[model samples]
Target: MTIRPLPDTLVNQIAAGEVVERPASVVKELVENALDAGGTRIDIDLEEGGVRLIRIRDNGGGMPGDELPLAVSRHATSKIASLDDLEGVATLGFRGEALPSIASVSRFSISSRRTDDDHGHVLEIDGGRVGDVVPTAHPEGTTVEVRDLFFNVPARRKFLRAERTELGHIEDWLRQLALARPDVELRVSHNGKVSRRWKGESDLLSGMRLHEALGEAFRDAALRVDHAAAGLRLHGWIAQPAYNRASTDQQYLFVNGRAVRDRSVAHAVRQAYADVLFHGRHPAYVLFLELDPRRVDVNVHPAKHEVRFRDVRLIHDFVYRTLHEALAGTRAGTPSGAGVMPADNGPAPSPASPGIGGMTSASGYMPQAPLGLQVAETRAGYAALYGGLPAQATHDASTVAGPPQALPDSGDATLPPLGYALAQLHGIYILAQTAEGLVVVDMHAAHERIGYEKLKCAHDGEGLRTQPLLVPSSLAVSEREADVAEREAATLAELGFEVTRSGPQSLALRSVPALLAHGDVEALLRDVLADLREHGESRRVAAARDELLATMACHGAVRANRRLTLPEMNALLREMEATERSGQCNHGRPTWARFSLPEIDRWFLRGR
Candidate 1:
């Protein structure tokens, strides 16, 4: 077979295969064009789920009569003119293929009139056949009407879902766009009945719109997050750990005002919520991450619902750290809301006054040097404050020594975030009263999170203590492995691994971190070398360190069924308030829950 150029109509039809998947796809393309035209108010009318007709009207800058024909021509776009313009495309719709592609598959008509013009020009196309441009009624904007989508291609039309299903897809996409652009008003009608309308909002993330989109539950349990650093800004509402969903429908993430579903961003979010949400439950959030346009590529997919960040790890860490810090105050409420999580390139927030839990640093539980393990100074300060005793003495006095005698003032505004513990229910739940109302806490889970944070601090604060192997374990390896061992000898030392190339294809491990948990040291070393060779960096050392700390915390934490005195319970509550990440246990289960007076009153049917 000889190769030949496909016809213009065929080319557009092929492009339509990508740009127009269903009626919803047509809705997306048209709305994007409206947004690019500087549309402020858009009204959409749908008939039979947009299959019979999709009429979109936008009050934006309209086009002249001469441009009406070009609007239906391929590769005719006003958004970009040069290669540099493509590099940082600020417009929502740049690809000129949308108009021509839709025209090739359906009966299409678009009309527009400039603000100064007395009349608008309209052009129609039926299955790639262009009609004469005619005068239309006056409107200082643009309106596009598409009828019988995929009518020329019966096979494609056959693939479309039911009417309601197609309309649902359109509604879902609109909601996502509304999240990023709260300034634009939107109106929708189905079968001539006005179905949905959202009044424009000036606030970046409007609580009213968010509640309308996500629900009042998500808004009630949301935390306002605003963090900006290193050319990246992440600000939005994140639902509390206790407020979650069975599915991931509520997680809406946008990069650079473009709604996108990225694995890197999603993974970062999942990791940030790792220890807070229950297993099988997904978090509800409407997070928006704003960064330089050049740093993200939004043209990766035809639908433009996914993006590729320039630096995956950098973006990932930014999103993860931002959300992680915002939710830290929920479990144990903040005192005056002073402490905040450190931004990507900044130091952690430190406490202004000395506290009961020895958490003097405002950065909460994060160590000054997580990688170097600098615990000696923290240990010394802790030792000196509570008398020169064992490090565990500063932990929980209730576990070893009996409960205290005299109680501190529990009345008025001086109570801790978790409030004063009134009693222990079933030796598991700690009942406390806060200014808000009643608070219930799981003793084991609360202690587990507290213990976990402290262990991580002490473990990271104290640099890894190297210990020589008693047997001096020897391992066989490849020639490349031997080279990596020699080249990364310093890196290994930094991670508490003292290894030297023993031969052309073997290595000798003589020392390891004393704090490192006992495991397959050889396997760990091999994995580290492999990671170093692949990514020029390794997470094995950090993962191993965290595993060890988690284990230690699990063992040291207060176990359930252990009786506690009133003073001990209150002391634990104070510690929780001062500690970061105390809202959820090590496993992401909520440690405490607030029950307002209204809820208690409702239960008792007060004033009924």
Candidate 2:
């Protein structure tokens, strides 16, 4: 067979396959074009998830009358003049494939006027055929209208989802763009119903406006994170530790103002908060990474969403260290409040919460600052001065003030007393007498492992039981995330998530895993999807799912600090014994360790 050139229409349909995936893809390309044109404000109006109509108007530098026709021409762009410009590309978008690709599948119209022009000129394209250019009155910017998307291609049109699903996509796209450029005023309307809007500003808190647009549940989980390091700057907000959702709807990531899906950065964030947070419960964040353009490559994909950093290891380390240091008490943004100094030194506070002194509750934990800033550590002498602990004894007497809580010694109990048959220490670990010597068990670790396996097996055997949500939970999500959700819809359904796309940028939750009986299903879905969206590709999706299981196991299992009665303890022991891999927890830490009778005797000076 001889090779032949493809027809223009066929060429465009193929391009549409790559560039025009859904209603949201069209929105993304159009929005990015508007932003690249130096738009300070953009308005998007959609009907029927942009399947019926889409209109975008921007207040930015417009195009010349002659350029109006070229705007719909294939490979036409003012973003790059030549190859050299690629090295220093700083704009959010540089590809010229968007307009033509979009117009091929939809009836398209573009009207524009330079600031110096008397009026605007409108050029139309009906399924890639150019309509006559006509004079039109308009502002010194650009307004693009797209109608009857995928009309000529019935196959593509058939794949179009429900109106609700398409609208959800649109909603997600708009909000993420709004978050990326808070300095630009954005307003979105669908079918004449107001959807969302954001004012342009540099203020970090501006993204919080999404709470009003999206809802209070979303706002509560939101947290703010910002820090700068050597040549690399990180700025964004995350949901509070307690605020996590099941889906990845709330996560937004940007690399120099262009939205991205980079797992290295997201994993670092998760690792930084690992110890304190449960699995499955993801931290929702809108993170921005800014470094020299020379150090990053944004040309990896046609969409330009995937990037290759020159020093990914360095980037990873920087993100992890900075996030961890900020969350931990290592780096202080604010001065420590006045407090007593230790005459010399004292044992370090629990690793999880530091700088938090004077237990208000018996748990000895304290909340962070209101703005999500690191809590200022109380100084060494601080405890004495604050009368938190008696000066005579540095250690908190309450830790071991009374006799150890007694355990029942009934006929069911047995002791082989050439030495103590078993001795439980600190009420946290258990020691059992054995013919060889003795065995030690970390109750928390052991139970966690057992619970994790049970959950995994149940998840495999019987799909997650879904509990219906009383009110539909709505959230904004990126298009890539939407694709993942759609692709994994079957799996998600098994997990008890009855999620249907509601817009080009949003998702609606109708149900959740029934096992999460008392959980905030909407929030859980958001967090799960956020984690998947941010870190899914780099890390194994299965591993992330494991983390989710860990989260559920942690919440459902008995806590480490909680005191248990004998029956509860015995039941835990039996469960651990029956468990296949009971030696370690789901996180891979040893659940139990053994010490022989001789070792215990030596510690008591029975042998030297």
Candidate 3:
């Protein structure tokens, strides 16, 4: 058969295949359009889980009657007009294919009335057949109705899941939207009964909105992050390492107000939590990254759920460093104020409280000691354990002085976050009294974190140690990987690897990070090359180095069932307050937990 141009309806149906996957896809596109139109309030009414009918009304700037027909025409979009506009497009619905594509696959109607218009106009489309626009009465906004989704295409319709499943997808998308735009009011009704509602708030980053969307547990554990630098701004809430999840279901990332999935950002977050998160556990975060539109290409994916960054390395490093520094303040005894709950129907919780006591303030605390000096001063016993004989451990352990007999009362002074140690529980937990209540600490876990952090500081100060290969390892890789390895040789060297291109598609690894020298050098090189090629950087070397340091710290940490004096336990508590990321051990388990006076009172019925 001779090749010919596809008819308009067939062309539209084909485009629909790419944009209209299911009812949830339809909701995403239409809702995006509403947001782009400056909608402040959106109401969605769905029947049969949006499979039978979906009617969305938005209080936004409505289109003119004349443009109503053109709105459903292919490639007709007001979002972008030229190549330059396309390069820096910021709106969510710039492609303009959603309206026509969605119209072709379902029975659709759009009614709108601009604020200045005398009356409203409505346009209808039936399975790709356009109808004339007619006058109608409507509020000063826009309303879009879609029925019989995938009716014209039985194949696509058959692929749709059950009603409950489709509605779940729609609800999930709405939740993501609500997270990014707390300023927009969203209400949903399923089969005529209200299902969910997100009230608009003046503050976009309100903690109440977070609580409502993600639940109280996440809100209580969230650490607000807002930092701007180098033409990029990253702000959002990241759950504390102790509040990690088994899966990444709670991870939400939005770039420039658009929800998207970026592996580079995800990898950076994972790396930031590498030392504190338990193996196989995923950290939960709701982060928003803002950069110049020209620096990121959102048109890479049809659904606009993925993007291509102009400088992946710069982005990766920025995210990693910001989050890394933020998490460092997770030291034990720091009252983040994240655990405080707001009163019923009250204002959003206040920002995190400032540091307490004469110890280092959370905002100003920066570990200044290099490896040997700080460790020697604060943890001499652990150092002795690492170097000296086991018989000498007892002598070194006695060096830590006990607190004074007369401890300062909470009424008279601001106690340290962890308070004063009272006694040791079974030689494992350090029981202490705080201004608010009881503080229970896992001695081994707390010491492990302290030692791990100190070791990292020392390692960072001295730089990575490289072990030269007696016989250079030769590995064959893809041409792209080889090119990346050659281009990033200096970067590799910084990570303690000396890689050189041997052939068009081959590499020679002359040296590797000493910490991972015994591991699979070939596999390591391959993994590093893959990361570099995709993300413009790799953390495999650092991760491997940290693993070794973590093991060392674990062994050097105080073991359970070991006897400890009141002074020794108090000294350990003080060190925990000073150490960065001390709230969790090297394995991500929380090192301590606080039981406030009120909670304890309820447990014992003391108030009653």
Candidate 4:
């Protein structure tokens, strides 16, 4: 082995491997440098996903003439002056390799001048070689022009995606940066035309405006979270329960004004949302965490995309608690147009009028709140509101009562026709005869599955059945649960649930789905409400619907342990044969597995 310095070209290419993974990476670095230099306005232009050209200009403090060349050299100065600075990184461009790495593999040119300077100088580097340092006229700031990215690396170029997809990546990165620095104006152009632009403005309203421009469904459901404790301040907007996407692309996270991904921060969010949302559904949030820079480490990666928190547990707990509180207060008010679940019946309470230290009735139906939210005063409030009431009053008046007065069959021709027939099982399962197979069915599972599908379709805007609450029942929940409920309101309404706040921490129960025949409305409400609290907003609706079906199926299905007559069994078998997808039950479990005569004989050891 020889220990010698590598060739300049080879070294540059190797560095490029880390700094330039895709067009988005280049944009991220350039834009970040602009921001670090105190740029309040930036413009980005791209062509063919940066394969042909990429240009970034920023109105920031620019480099002086003598410093132009060092800007493109590996491990150069600025950003970090000492090892101690590494311990508490605040800037986004500490690793000085980005410029050189990008320059080595592409045609790079930079024109920069200090804000006070009268004119800027242009410097060009082609394939890692300095071509010239000529004087040029330009506005105050810096502009870096990149052409033919990955030109010398054919293999890397081959990995580049289609132009549209590459552009999507670039757009996504720009949006993230825009979210982090809402105070900075950003303009992006691709293929010589303006594609995306954001005139950075402070405040949640401005952020929402940017979200609308991005067209990522960021505006559907948004929650404002602002809390401060023990030297850490958490502020940002979370998606309402009714607003959620099918992917993680909508989530924008920032820590101390720098956009970096920290698992601890994400986990805190997820944990806070646990039990309020459905599995596999993520909540959309643009959360900003502000704390002393000394409490975190940002020098973990060359790209500066991740960080390490000094007190991870504390951070997690703080975020979880803060969001949980904010959601609780917000959920107590009337749901917004975004389709948040209406508060249970009770006196309305807003974050501005948080009840002193008592868990509301809504809390009874939700997952346990964080210790911070379980204030003594809140507990007393919960006791005063619901403690002495009879069990039936606190639960549901409908349990002792019966179904809502069914109107005489309405002569409405618009209602679709439904065929109904039932064959009894060995006292448990039901066999329903249908055009398909005999439709041997698990009565409970089938009903539950049907209910879920129906609810989902309705929530998707295909159909809906709203059940109004006769008496609004107040529901008390942790802030996170409340948030989830708000996000999934439309979906819940589709399932025939009309939730509204009846009192502080109390949601009134006015109506329930007609299909959910005879069940404990109070219990069902508890389960549905709790699901929203655990999962994020996106999952909240699905969770509630699933729970409803689960309860329906449980009560409606045939009991497995019960015996049946021969006729009943035969009828059940016939119904099973007639059902669609009869092989599987609701919850995706197989309903039944058949054995042929030959298999039965084999089991008896009668095989010749």
TM-scores, all candidates, are: 0.82, 0.58, 0.91, 0.59
lDDT of 3 by residue, 1-608 (tens): 99999999999999888898899999999999999888999999999989999998998999888999999999899999999999999999898899999999999999999999999999999999999999999998899999999898999999999999999999999989989998899999999899998999976455377777788888878888888999999998888888889899999999999999999999999999998888999999999999999999999998888999998999999999999978877778766546331111211111122111123333233222211112322133333323522221442333443334766696645567788778888878999998899999998898778767766665565556788999998888889989989898998899888999999999988998876787887888788888988888888888877777777777767788877665556666766776678889988899999999999999989968
Query: Arrange candidates by lDDT, highest first: which order?
Result: 3, 1, 2, 4
lDDT of 4: 0.61
Worst-scoring 10-residue span by lDDT in model 2: 331-340
Candidate 2 residue spans exceeding 4 A from truth:
206-210, 213-223, 330-608
Error of 3 at 475 (Å): 2.9
lDDT of 4 by residue, 1-608 (tens): 97999998789889889879988899888888998899999999899978799999999989887799889888885988888886777788887889989998889999998878878999999888887788889888999999999888899989999999988888877777776777888888889999877877875454455455435455545656678999999886776534455677667778888887876678667755542454677778887899988898887776778877878757877887887555433321123323232333332222222211222222222111211111111122322211221111122323322323332232443211111124455544554332222334454443333323323333333233344555555666555545545656665566566666543445545677543424565666566666444332223334454455444434434445443333333323323332222233444443442233456567778857
Q: List all candidate RMSDs to the true structure.
A: 6.5, 21.1, 5.8, 19.5
TM-score, model 2 to reference? 0.58
Model 3 ranges off by over 4 Å: 205-207, 337-392, 395-404
Candidate 4: deviation at residue 491, Å? 39
Q: Residue 508 of model 1: what lDDT?
A: 87
Model 1: per-residue Cα lDDT over 535-576, one tens digit each: 445557766766665555665566687766665676566656
lDDT by residue for model 2 (79-192), tens: 889777776689877777889899889999999999999999999899988788898999989999999999999999999999999998888777777767778888888999
Best-performing candidate as measured by TM-score: 3
- Residue 187's lDDT in candidate 4: 87
| Clashing residue pairs for model 3 | 402-567
The predicted structure with the larger TM-score, 1 or 2, is: 1
Off by over 4 Å in 4: 213-217, 330-333, 337-608
All candidates' lDDT scores? Answer: 0.75, 0.65, 0.81, 0.61
Deviation in Å, model 1, residue 83 alpha carbon: 0.7
